[model samples]
Target: MGGFFSKLGLSCGIFCALVARFPLSAQTKQAQNPVIFADVPDLSMIRVGGNYYMSSTTMHMSPGVPIMKSTDLVNWRLVSYAYDTLASNDAMNLANGQSTYGRGSWASSLRFHNGTYYVSTFAQTSGRTHIYFTKNIEKGPWKAVSFKPSYHDHSLFFDDDGRVYLVYGGGKLRLVELTADASGVKPGTTEQVLIENAGAPAGPNTGLPAEGSQLFKIKGKYYLFNIVWPKGGMRTVVVHRADKLTGPYEGRVALQDLGVAQGGLIDTPDGQWYSYLFRDFGAVGRIPYLVPVTWADGWPVLGTGGKVPETLALPASKGLIPGLVASDDFSRRPGAPALPLVWQWNHNPDNALWSLTNRKGYLRLKTGRVDTSFVLARNTLTQRTIGPTCSGATALDVSQLKDGDFAGLALLQKRYGLVGVKRTKDTKSIVMVSAESEKPVEIQRVPLTQNKIYFKAECDFTDRKDVAVFFYSLDGKAWQKIGAPLKMAYTLPHFMGYRFGLFNYASKNAGGYADFDYFTISEQISKE
Candidate 1:
């Protein structure tokens, strides 16, 4: 029997060698772990069947609450949007050209219960909360349900006893029980589980209000996780657990100070749990960060050891989970599409203005009139800056534009911090300029005609308060100083990091479009 087994092993080895030598097709590689999907913030995820569904706050961008689907914890793709029309004409008219940076939906909660999917968001304009539900996740003809505004960062909690509750606000944590129909709060059913000024280690600070509440049950104890802001600083996630779902809960710090942390807990089928956190990387705005969570005593802890871990080795997911890759080379591949995960717009996105077709090998952006207000109209393709010190490069050809046409790259921080190349018919020259809050101050204007120009912007976020911006004309050639390095700290009410992208603004109508060869973003990793 030993001799026969040895012969069988040798025969199997020979067979494997032959198969390798005469391979039918290229072997598919297993997806990498901790796949980075940049700029996805305030992440709320739920496991449905064998798939994971996640959603984040869309702000003023149309199609609010971007719903993403994933098989493994990592590798997410945009599936659908919760709100079809983000802000209608009526909603925008109410905004009145003001920026809704902190006012829009901060953090949103997504949950699937009893074969139905539910999502809730805190709309600041009306000072009211709205919940939407759909029978199917992908194709959502979502119906909206309105309630009194508790606060931003709202979440839904379903008790095991067939009762539902809504938890929201940070400073004054409000929890109200709901009827089974989820129509309105149960008659005479209202409770304030945690008050901001009452039970805090330190007194409640101004501006640094608490909000973004989430409830989870572990080890038969219910934990209420929420964000707390302490007197002019970035908000952090904290938790308080109680023996009963609704009770006099004790507040404890789960995640503190450490940059900005939002989002909540998601449990995999295998019982492993993780919490999503957001960090503000200058020029990247707030990007998502995942941390392994564990329950200690009764409080929850994030990261590996109180410190936020940059990367980790996650357990292999049981089945195949898709990966997140918004990068495009424009060389038509089997599954490659023009639409990426990062592109967003105010109001409904016009599909006619953008496309990836055989005629244009690059992403062609049609020139349109600049929206008088940044919040109202700006045709820009942007992605979050995930690293403090990162660089983005893109190749653009604006030769088709007549005078008064401008197309270039930019590093955006809300209404300010825009640096790029522009072209006007006056001189038929491509000028490099920087805009701080939509005020375009000429930097360095250069001439380029009928040639595809390469543009790059590097943001030194080591000192985000004083960010430096530099531009390069070609891939690896002469680098020119565009303008005086500007201080970005005072640009907005809340100073978040910068975002990079390609934008085209036309003061006068231009017949042609701006064609982009490609856009690439890279973050510098600290050696430590």
Candidate 2:
């Protein structure tokens, strides 16, 4: 990947100009909270030498457990994935009307020890916890290892004594030992309760009890971080400390600002330590925020005066676009890969159903089988739809589409809005469907004779007034509003932000395909 720019004939001056276009970190500029603003949740980060690598949870989306790299902690780019596929399950493949929207994989733990990188994630759909290890973290052929009985939000810790352990479980935190090879649990080793209710000294938890547990040994003292929701309160961060690995631990509240909790820690080479946490920003999924950590009296304290600062003594944000979101021409450069890392399939996609090289400059999405709904569609390419104000547009060719095929741009979520070309046995037509409140209902339709068309969806999330509008174009320059305003929402069923998706699904026939020429995004003035 390092040679990608060189293959594209980008000179040093051009590269420097491109770097200058990205966000600049001034000497006085402080890193803002929510460093990476996308649905990068359940984060577990580690610093390898001068480079920082973070593994995050992208549940149900194929190429799971995304590994991101950043020179500065603020700007990150997706480099690799721990697993290309989770498992062969009906829920994972969107079969039998079942989907693994929020339950495929959860809260991953990333670690680097003894010149090797390890990432552990649990999948409810497969009922197993997978451990992936690689010598080279960025470029890889990562090997997979899994065990039965998935532990909820577990942490993988390797101690100095050559002992490997898994610290896992919910309100009652438990610890179990693994074989030296990390194949499975060591038999006859007693699994002990590490912390009861995450040692919440307050009353019994009224909200979600202690969960999202991550353990770390800092300064030769064991420290564990967990997120708990108090009664009628936001998500809170709780930390516990102990001298021994498996002993009685003391606990306290670490942070409570906007529910940014539940990640491990990373330190700079210069010895500055910070806790990587995430907050649930509506419609954009869980966004990661960095908090400064200082040691006082042998305990790692978070933030200033128990409050999360808006800015930190680190690199400024690069605006979550360059790496996380991008405008693509669907054309591969001299040595470019077929697709950018920013794109992901809705679920485990049928590899044979999509291609970029098959058609020189267009993305060809072929339907593998018949589907009843969009949720059951097999190949839906998606990217994060950033908030405040943004719009995504795509031009699609429906000439090769068979009857009952719907191919177009969609704002995908539980309650989604779709503007696409729906082909019938006799004619082709453009339709707009909105799932603003109830199930999707068609709001408008336009009969089409041409085989190609352009579509766009604009989203506004300023002041939490989430809404989406759809538009269509006969010519690329002339656009027409075609649908009622969709009251966009962030629902738990999807458990994700609104994503701009290019989807092709067969409602009746099977071998239909669509060609997407390009996809572009533009940030607009806030509609607040």
lDDT of each: 0.63, 0.86
Tell me the tens digit of each residue's lDDT in model 1 across 291-324.
7787676567786767666554453332211233
Cα error, candidate 1, residue 75 (Å): 4.6
Please provide TM-scores, in order, for all candidate models, with all chains considered together.
0.75, 0.92
Off by over 4 Å in 2: 1-28, 525-528
lDDT of 2 by residue, 143-236 (tens): 9999997988999999999899999998899999998878788999899999877837434654788888888888799999888888878788
> Cα deviation of 481 in candidate 1 (Å)?
6.1
Per candidate, the number of residue pairs that clash is: 9, 0
